[model samples]
Target: MVDVLEAGGWGLLAGSALLLGAVLGYTLRIPHQVVASVMAFGAGVLLSAVSFELALEAYDRSGMLPLVLGTVAGAAAYTAGNVLLARRGARHRKRSGQVRGRSQPSEGQQAGSGLALALGALLDGVPESAVIGLGTAEGGAVSAVTVAAVFISNVPEGLSSSAGMRGAGRGKGYVFGLWGSIAAASMVAAAVGSAVAGALPASAVAAVTAVAAGAILTMVADTMIPEAFEEAHQAVGLIVVAGFLVSFALSRA
Candidate 1:
């Protein structure tokens, strides 16, 4: 119970960034380049965490088979969900409604996009938060690197998505409500992850961890990187590398 509470707290702490970003996006007029740069950095951080913390840890725990199978399964699952959501007008859920060469979504497209965007955010966030609980179940301190990575990444997610929502004509109430619900859900996800991982065997835990890594990696490649490079161009690579190095150093430390 105590561990679960701790996991919830950490998950909320991480997830809270989404609300903060939403507030910023709704209130302020941030530049696309800035948003792109931050998104790239967050993507890099998540990539590093997936590589060093999740996939490697899973490999160390139960060897190669579980890791490979779990990762493939996770990637496939996320891809399928993404496809379904895309068809519902969430294909550009991560955009700020202002793609460089693309026109904004029409009223008909925006009509159903709010729900799809919210669901898409949930899909991206749950697995990441679950891994926090999984870390806690390992009998020591929770992984700070994981928490930090998720927090950093979530800020841009909320910022960009909320900005897009606003562009799509969503009201402030809707924007805040959407992010608030997701934040609360993240807390529940972390607690549930802790509880479930606590009951699972080592091999099972390894598989689950690998699954999250795979999904996150796919998200980065499909959603984050393209958005990051959309505006920032060459410099986004440097920022990504810097973010990756920072996360890698934290993991090593």
Candidate 2:
């Protein structure tokens, strides 16, 4: 089971990397509104998967108390880190406000947007990968399915990164860097998840899973939902429901 899970996990991780590359290499050409809708749907599927599969499994394996504590701890830690990053970004944006308004950037500022994009991808990459890795480590039954689910969830992320680059008027090479950063982070997360899985208690894993789910849920509601709505598309709710059904169906089968 471990061997099967590991193999499936690696495949999923690689698939995620490929999906990201495809987005950078090709999918960015799609319209922004369409992209936003797909992203929202993906987010809904992923958030639901994490809650129903990973967190719930952890709780069943461990206990409710551990799950609750771990979720809180995970949320608190991520929240703190996010807050810090936001503050730093705000400060930097303030200092660079004059430059942003300009038509062109100085040499030092030229790569700033790409750099920021890479940094954001780096922050998100590890955790996303870890979640996938954990899903696989839990067993063969969920391994391949988890990977596919995450791959779909990540489509929007890759799109968002690419869109940011395009909007910033950055080159294709710079956009590709964002995907590369995410792939690299996924690799790191897979390594970490595999290594730690053997030593961690079920409770610890459950807690982390809960925390991850919460963050992902927040992202879906705050970012993806808003983006999906801005496109004047009324089909978003249906798409979201469809995405959830797809994720659930895949997991069950």
Candidate 3:
């Protein structure tokens, strides 16, 4: 119980990025290029975490078959969920703020619903938070780099998404409340992950981890990179490389 609580606390700490980003979006008029650059950098950090921390670990433990299957399922799950949300008017779930002001009013309504941001945050955050707990289950501290990667990635997610939603007419209170709930959910996921770590077999761990990797990779490829390029243009590639190298170095440390 204590361990679970500790994991939950850490998850809360990490999840705070969402609220922080939302605050920035609500309070500041961030430039378009800055949003794009940050998104690109966050994508790079997330890529490193997925590649080295989640994908490699899953491959090592569960072999290729399980990892592949899990990856497929994870991607499918996120894609389906995104499609459903898009249909419901949250098409800007992963969109950068620069282009979002052009949406129709009805589309704004959907964005204001806040469901898209919440779901998107969960799709990305839960898995990483679970990994934190999984580390604790191994009788060790959570990887500092993993936390950094997740936290940093989440900031852009919150910032960009919040900007879009705010442009769509969502209230500051609504955005703050949405990110706050996400933070709480993250805490729950972390605690539950660690609590169940002892019961889950290594195969289960690997498959789940692979699921996260797949989902994150799909999200980055499908949404993040595209959005970054849309705004940041050529410089995003270098920033991506820089972000990846930095996260990679942290992982190595």
Highest TM-score, which number? Answer: 1
Ranking by TM-score: 1, 3, 2
Query: Residues 1-253, candidate 1, lDDT per residue (tens digit)?
Result: 8998998888888889888888988788898889889989998999999999999999999999999998998899889988897888876554445566687677546545656656767887788788898788675578978998999888887886777677677899989988998998889888899888857887888898888888889989988888789789989889999889989999999
Q: Give the per-residue Cα lDDT of candidate 2 at 150.
A: 62
lDDT of 2 by residue, 1-253 (tens): 4543464357446546534643552443665567667776776686667777766776887888877776666556555655654443311221112332544433333234334434544555566567656655656333554566567666665654454445456666656755755676676676567657667877777776776665556556655666676562578788888778888887777
Candidate 3 per-residue C-alpha lDDT over 149-247 given as tens digits, one digit per residue, 9 for 90 to 100:
888888877886677677677788888988999988888888988999989988899888888888888888877888789779879999888889999
By lDDT, rank the candidates, best first: 1, 3, 2
- Listed in order, each prediction's TM-score against the native is 0.93, 0.75, 0.90
Q: Worst 10-residue stretch by lDDT in candidate 3?
A: 91-100
The candidate that achieves the highest lDDT relative to the unseen native structure: 1
Off by over 4 Å in 3: 92-114
Residue 141 Cα positional deviation in candidate 2, in Å, after optimal superposition: 5.4
Candidate 3, residue 66: lDDT: 81
Which residue runs does candidate 1 get wrong by more than 4 Å?
A: 93-99, 108-114
- Computed on alpha carbons, the lDDT of every model, listed in order, comes to 0.83, 0.58, 0.81
lDDT for residue 70 in candidate 1, whole number 0-100: 87
